[model samples]
Target chain A: MKAAVIVFPGSNCDRDLAVALEKSSGKAPIMLWHRETEVPQDLDLIAVPGGFSYGDYLRSGAMAAHSPVMREVKRMAEKGVRVLGVCNGFQILTEAGLLPGALMRNRDLKFICRDVHLKVENTDTAFTGPYTKGQVVRFPVAHHDGNFFADDELLKRIEGNGQVAFRYAAADGTVSDATNINGSRNNIAGIVNEKGTVLGMMPHPERLIEPKLGGADGKPMFDALVEALS
Target chain B: MKAKVHVTLKNGVLDPQGKAIQHALGSLGFSGVDDVRQGKYIELDLAETDAAKAREAVERMCKELLANTVIENYAISIEG
Candidate 1:
């Protein structure tokens, strides 16, 4: 599958994501700059990697979301291309209106960086299809504004529609309030858009894909991309 | 003409930065302070001389970009 990683000026995780995509898909992805308004033709997947894009100005992902590249990203999504956004990338997706809800300041007002357990809540979408539902995996989360917020009614709608892809869970894989890594509503760690073509999550799955990196639990997410597209 | 926009987190939305400021005040023996909610003040220099037009433009900027309506509210004032 052909893939590209969008690189904002301050995006530090772009290469990490590119490496993971290359390893999983057997094809190196193009590193697209944020200023470009056009995407490579017939792209199967696009990833907006994590980092303090635009230095997290005016809200975590707000400024970078307005970069010219995002307008193309949204247009590509409408055409059924799979899009993955992690951490600050997640914030960008929400701000760009590709994903619902906004990521607010973390409840404790601290930039949290740690390994956390996430329960795979949905196994039908391309992003999470390779992971077993209810399985617990470790992913590192590093961010300050990971708190996800939405009105009660909208929260219910996404939940009822099975849009939630991952929830913070204990080591045993049981989800609970105490297990919430960030102050995400309903302990949500990841969510997919209603179309199932886009996903936004706070955790960095790319960081866990190599065994030497810690664990290869994140490999399946990358693997799922190749499997679904090809 | 100049326009100033105030952007603040909506009521009931958690403001950790604001809470931190509150804590700092208490540590300084300012016990009379009950709460502290911080927001942004943005000043803009407008090319348009008409106050009404400037206000409308700034309001659009607030809704479209300046403030995230989902979690924050923005108020705009124009001065000539």
Candidate 2:
């Protein structure tokens, strides 16, 4: 799979995401800067990595979302190119209108950095095809504005369409209040679009692809994308 | 002419910074603080004179830089 990782001014995780994609797909992905108005032709996947893009000024992901490259990203997503946005990338996707809902500040008014347990709510999407429904996975979340909010009707629409891909869960794969990091409504941790081609998640899966770092659960997500596209 | 654009999170959206300010005020013995919502005010000095053009410019600035419309809304007012 020919993938491209979008890089903005403050994108700190571009290398991490690139390494993860290279290892999983056995092909080094292209690194595209935010100022470029075009994506690589015939690209199968585009990954937007996490970071304090544009110094998080005005709002997190606000400035980066308006970057010239996002116009191409939006165009590709509409054409069914697979897109995965992690952490600040998620915030960017929402700001760009490629996804619904907004990521707000944590309810506790503090930055949360910890390993959070998540439930695989739907494994049928292009991003989660390697996981099983109800499976538990651990991914690290480090952010200040990770609280996800949407209107009641939109939430129901997303849930009813089985677009919710992951939810916070207890160690035994049970939904619980203790695992609800950032107090996101209904413990939402990740979601995919109705077409299953675009995904946005809060956790840093790119940081956990190796066992030496901590866990290898994130490998399957990248692997699944490669397999489905290649 | 100058225009000021005020961007604020919509009502019912969680305002952590505002909450922190409210708590700080309470700790400092300030009472009657019913609520607090943090926002941004951006002043733009434009060369355009037409009110509609100025308003349009400010609106574009808000959408393109001053605010994230997904979570926040903005209002623009022109000043002499």
Q: In order, what lDDT does every prediction score?
A: 0.91, 0.90
List the pairs of residues colliding in candidate 2: none
DockQ of each: 0.82, 0.71
Candidate 2 lDDT tens digits, B1-80: 89988899988777888989999999999999999999988888999889888998888888877887657899999977
Query: What tens-digit string does per-residue lDDT give for candidate 1 at A115-226?
Result: 9999999888999988888999999999988999987888999999899999989999988879987788999988999988999999999999988999998999999899
Q: Whole-model lDDT for model 2 versus the true structure?
A: 0.90
Q: What is the TM-score of chain B in candidate 1?
A: 0.97
Fnat of candidates, each listed: 0.78, 0.78
Q: Report how closely model 2 matches the true complex, as a DockQ value.
A: 0.71
- Residue B67, model 2: Cα distance from true site in angstroms: 2.7
Where model 1 places Cα greater than 4 Å from the true spot, the runs are: none
Cα deviation at A26, candidate 2, in Å, is 1.1
